[model samples]
Target: MKNITFCDQYGQLGGGQQVLLELVKAALENRFTVQVLIPEGPCADKLETLGVEVRRISNCALTQGKKSVLDVMRFAMYNLSVFFNNFSVLRSADLIYVNGNRLLPVAFFAQRILGKEAACHIHLNHGKLEKKLFRIFLRQRRTSAIVVPSAFIQRELVHFDTAFDSPKVRIVENGLDARFTSTAFEDRFSSRPLRHVGIVGRVSPEKGQDVLPALARRFPDMDFHVMGDAAFSSADFYATLRRDSPANVHFHGWVEDLPQKVREIGLQICLVPSRCPESTPGHSFEAAPLVPMQMAALSCLVMVRRLGALEDIAKSLQLISFDSDEELIPMIESLRVQPAGEPLALCENSHKLAVSRYSHNSFHENLKGLLRALIPV
Candidate 1:
């Protein structure tokens, strides 16, 4: 078997981790021997059931919140342990595939020692330290190539770093299971008012969780739902959001059954407030924008605050884009009162787009081909 050892930045379950799970499933179905390097958490149990060998690296540096000298030393010690402990797998694997940029340094280190082929799938577009880390990947030779989920990342890579002028990078758009796109949502709720509007994902400052409460205050009658939990986020921010939240705004923390929850709540519009999580203030990149796509695939109307990077995928979908809070309020109000005829038509159109564009079958084929090319038998 051509063994491919996969790695994730965190084994804690999240959107990216879920995608990693899907990739794990694909790798196995393709008949490759698969292994995973991750911090021990709930995700390990899931990966284990899938029959892949799981290697746990204790207390990863990427998840460390406070930056201090001791923290740096601790991170170094753990990484050194990872390099030595997982040496057998690291050195012998046909390919080392890491999930995100945080693990690129570790991948680079393993590649240098073993001279094995590797791929780093970067899900985010821009970070100040990205160029420095990516430059090291190119010069070091072991990291092999970069795989990105969107054209926004490919563009950002070229614009920000000189190393990308070579053929060391490829763009693969994120895909969803066909079940979501094919789901038949009978318009039973269409007759009801478009009362429930919300955002979905981790509750963090950059993710716009705190902004939801104030947005709820603007319209007392309409209920605004914040559907997520605060993990790997600022405690104070989560606390602040709850403190000021009014009677109408509800925070349902960490929803697992999203489709069921959407049905129960009668969610009419989805507000996706995202930015380039890695970029500086006022800077955003073209990311794949996972949640909005999911909602659209499920035949829900969406409104987004995005520009160049996500514009291409979202352009064909019937999503309202807003540049500022000023624009969002009026739009939300209009959608709340307006007849459902237009939004319903847009939702149906988006379902068709979602089916053609983001199929899991295509994602797996692209990934298998990428891995095969990297590790030639």
Candidate 2:
């Protein structure tokens, strides 16, 4: 079996780390000897549970929102240590897969010095400087593939540098498990009046969790639930949210089984109030967020902000999209008073699209094919 080493910067179970776990499982199913190099956290534990080799590394101490000059210097210093520490593991693998953009510097060094072939999977639409820096490493001969989860990210890259418009760039959308899609339609659809609304993701400024208090105050009768924790650099935001939120707003911190918890809360509507990149330059925007598809599969009506890949996914799934924070109130009011059948029809259609277009089986096959092709014969 060919060996494949996957490198990731974060140890937390965020969206990108979740995707990395799925990719590791796919590699194992294809009979590839899989090994992961990541920081010590839940992600490494999950990989170990799956019977894959896991190596712990120092955390990449990059700032989450806006990076300062010191943040850049610290990350540069961390990259040097990463290069020396993980060199052996990277050299032994037939294919080196860098799962996040922050890990690209080490991947570039490995490809240049060790003559190894590497693939970089970028999950977010980065800012101008980051995009330019990425182009330098991605343009190298040893960087075999530039994998992005959505066409929006591909467009973002190409818009910045036309050189990214090459065959090496590939779009592989994130997928949901079949169990979510297999949830019975009638079980999820209810004629009862919808009262519960949920916002699922990390509690951060860009995630727009700050807007939830205003929404809670606007709709007193409706309960708003936040189904995630203040991971990374959002503890202050979380504290502020707790202080300002009305009685109708609830915070369910870091759920272990998110899908089941979502069902238990009986969420009728899910919101993706992510901030647009036009307003915040350095902050990362959502690129193919798995929450919308997950909620759609569970038959919850999804409404998203018209930003990045969210707009594309919303258009494809026929979900609602609002351009601003003010627009959400009116949109939610409309959905609240609309005919039950109308919302049910939309949810049913979205569920069907999620099943047919973004199933886990299809994701595994496509990722497996990519890994197989990248490995030398």
Model 1 CA deviation exceeding 4 Å by range = 61-75, 276-279
Clashing pairs in 2: none
Error of 1 at 40 (Å): 2.6
Model 2 per-residue lDDT tens digits across residues 1-377: 78889999888888898889888877887789988989998888988999988999888776655689999998888887888887888888877899987877888778888888889898888787778877887788888898899988888889888999988898888887544656655434466887989999888878888788898899998899998888665688899899999999999998778778877888888898998544466444787799999888888899988888898999889998888898988888887788888888999998899877888889878887877777754
Best prediction by lDDT: 2
Cα lDDT, all candidates: 0.73, 0.84
Off by over 4 Å in 2: 186-189, 277-284
Model 1 / residue 167 / CA error / Å: 1.9
- Model 1 residue pairs with clashes: 286-309
Q: TM-score each candidate.
A: 0.91, 0.95
